[model samples]
Target: MNTVYIGLGANLNAPEAQLRNALDALSKSQELTLAQVSSFYASKPMGPQDQPDYVNAVAKLTTQLSAIDVLDLLQQIELQHGRVRKAERWGPRTLDLDILLYNDAQIATQRLTVPHYGLCEREFVVFPLLEIAPKLTLPGGQALADIAASLPHNGLTAISQYDEAASLA
Candidate 1:
């Protein structure tokens, strides 16, 4: 099984519930084993200020599926939660699930990018990632804790812990 970290974010349609429901979906997948999950976080949107602040968190899972397959699964989960793709970047969405890392492998393809292109720079992504895996090092050798220390929180705030039972219920 390959260990993977997924970044979850949503700013619309009850954002926090969207994330929790997504987590429940992931846990129900037969090929994926839900592992550690960071506390939920709220942060300002990365692009347009007109959008609502996002609820974000990082999830760790072990999966037998390939990286691309995992990406497909995440996208499917996003879709089920009412995500809509548009031409604009960083626009508000009902759900966004990204594969932040895949078994320490560096990957680049038309469909996806591992270590997520914005992973180190986004406080919502980096800080919650640190909360779950404090000593993690990027595939390229950068220390996650160091990255967290260097990156500003950028108005990110912890909202609540992940409650698996409540989410699944």
Candidate 2:
């Protein structure tokens, strides 16, 4: 089984509820087993400050599926929760699920990238990732905690703690 990390975020229509629902949906997937979840964080919109603030969290899972399969599954969950891909990059949305890492695999494809290219740069992704997998080492051998500490993350704040056992079950 491959241990994967996923980032979840939403800023529109009961953001917190959307995140929780996403977690529940992921937990129901037979191909993936939700193992751990980070505390929810409230963050300012990164690309467009004009949009509403976002609620973000990260989940650690063990999956028997390939990278492409995981990506497809995530998209399915997003659609189920009313996610629409607009022309705007990093625009507001009902739900966003990103595969952050996959068992230290280094992948660069048109559809996805493992150890997500933007992982080190975004506090919203890194902080919660650290919470769930602090000892995780990226493909380049950088620890998640060290990477998070090196970045500028003054805007990320934890608003709610998620219980892994309760949320996954």
Candidate 3:
């Protein structure tokens, strides 16, 4: 099984509920075993700050599924949660699931890229990812904490505490 880290976020509707439901769905997937999740954070919207603040978190998992399979599953979860791709970049949504890392594999495919292209650029992703996998290193050899420390002051903050007990239940 490969250890994969996925980034989840949403600004529309019940953001926390969407994240919880998505995690629950992932936990029950045939090839995925939900591992750890960082605390949910409310971060200012990235692209256009006009949108609502997003609730974001990072999830670590062990999966037997291939990268493409995992991507497909994530997309399905987004669809189930009412995510729409028609909006402008970083627009508000019901849920957003991004594959942050898939083992140490370096892959650049038409549909996906391992070690997501924007992982290093977003404070929302870096902070929560560091919380869950402090020592984790990306394919670029940078530690999670190192990357997070390098991010500019972008107004990212841990708004909602991750309900660890409820998530595990």
Candidate 4:
């Protein structure tokens, strides 16, 4: 199994609950083993400010599925949650799952990119990612903490956490 990091974000339709549901769906998958989930960090919208703020978090897992397969699953989940793909970049959505890293590999396919294209610059991604894996490093060899520390981290606030007890019920 390959270790993978996934970034999750939502801004529509009960964003927090949507994130929790998505996380549950991932955990229940037979091909993937959910490992660590960081607390949700509420952050300002990355694109048009006309929309709502996003609740973001990071999830680490071990998966037998390949990178493309994982992307396919994530897309399916997004669609299930009423996400509609448009021409707009970083638009509001019910759920956004990004493949941040896939076992230290740099995968660039027609449909997906591991080490997600914006991992280093997005504070929403870095902060939650740090909470789950403090010592983690990107494919570029820079320490995760250093990258996170370098950013101003403005407009990001802790909202909630992944609750083991509630998830178990």
Q: Pick by TM-score: which candidate is best?
A: 1
Give me the candidate number with maximum lDDT.
1
As for candidate 4, its clashing pairs are: none
In model 3, the worst 10-residue window by lDDT is 159-168
Pick out the ten consecutive residues of candidate 4 with the lowest summed lDDT.
159-168
| Superposition TM-score, candidate 2 onto the true structure | 0.94
lDDT of 3 by residue, 85-105 (tens): 984787889999999999998
| Per-residue C-alpha lDDT of model 1 across residues 18-110, encoded as one tens digit per residue | 998999999999989999999999999988899999999999999899999999999999999999999999999999999999999999999
Tens digits of per-residue lDDT for model 4, 27-77: 888888899999899999987999999999999989888999999898988
How many clashing residue pairs are found in candidate 4?
0
How much lDDT does each candidate structure score?
Answer: 0.94, 0.90, 0.88, 0.90
Q: Candidate 2 — which pairs collide?
A: none
Kindly list the per-residue Cα lDDT of model 2 for residues 107-138, writing each as its tens digit: 99999988788889999999898887778888
What CA root-mean-square deviation does each model show from the true structure?
0.7, 1.5, 1.5, 1.0
Q: Is candidate 2 or candidate 3 better by lDDT?
A: 2
